[model samples]
Target: MRRILYAIAGTLSLITGLIGVVLPVLPTTPFLLLSAWCFARSNKRLHAWLINHKYFGPAINDWEKHKGIKASNKKRAYVLIVLSFSISIYVVPLTWVKVLLLFMCIALLWNMKRIKTL
Candidate 1:
């Protein structure tokens, strides 16, 4: 039951992370990290595959080894977050939603700032 739950969580996190590639509101790295952790607990093969993935592998490996993200990746993430949030805030009609997005943007920026840069 525990393993099954972990597998399910891993699959869901992996999907979300993939979607995050196109959706700036959804973070990619954290979800990928979650998937890696859940897969490591549930399925070795899946974990290994994720760790070896061309695009996602390096980030995971860096986090695992150094507990930090590269400065280049961090800069890219900051740019995307700012650009997307700016567009979304401008295009959104609902003031409340815009405010919520603003908060979310700040929180994400804060969290990213808290993470060590390699």
Candidate 2:
């Protein structure tokens, strides 16, 4: 049952990671990290695959080793957050919700910026 749950979580994390690749509003690293954690628990094969993955592996390894994002990735994340927040402010119906989201976005951006990225 624990393995099954971990597998399910890994699957969901992978899906979310894919979505993050296409949709700038969502984040890739967190999902990939979650996938790695789940894979580590559930399947050695999957854990190896994730750590060996071409696009994601380097970032994951960097994060695991140094708790840092690449500079390019950090810039991209900032841009995405700005664009997504602007879109959400215009599209969302509730002003309060938009403000809350804006606050959250700023907080996340600030946190990301504080992290030492290479």
Candidate 3:
């Protein structure tokens, strides 16, 4: 039962991670990390595959080893942050809400920037 649950979680995380590649609203690294964790619990083969994957393996391994993001990923994240803020500024009408959102955005950006990205 636990294995089955892990398998399901792994599959969902992988699907979400794939979708995140094209959709800026969905994050890629978090889902990939989730998938890796699930696979580790469910199947050794899958865990190995994810950790050794060509396109994503390096980022995942770096994150696992150092809790860091890659430089390219950091750049992409900054772009997304700007885009999201622009959208929120236009779409949200309430000044207080917008301010709150902006604060949250700044906090997240700061946190991401502080992480050791290579």
Best candidate (score: TM-score): 1
> What residue runs in model 3 are displaced by over 4 Å at the alpha carbon?
none
* Whole-model lDDT per candidate: 0.95, 0.89, 0.89
Clash pairs (backbone) in predicted model 2: none
**Model 1: CA > 4 A from native:** none
Model 3 local distance difference test score? 0.89
- C-alpha RMSD by candidate, in order: 1.4, 1.8, 1.9
Q: Please identify model 2 stretches exceeding 4 Å from their true place.
A: none
lDDT of 1 at 85: 94
**Candidate 2's error at 83, in angstroms?**
1.2
For candidate 3, the per-residue lDDT at 9 reads 96
Best-performing candidate as measured by lDDT: 1
lDDT at 45 for candidate 3?
94
Question: lDDT by residue for model 1 over 19-100, one digit each (tens)?
Answer: 9989877888999999999999999999999999999999999998899999999999899988999999999999999999
Clashes of each: 0, 0, 0
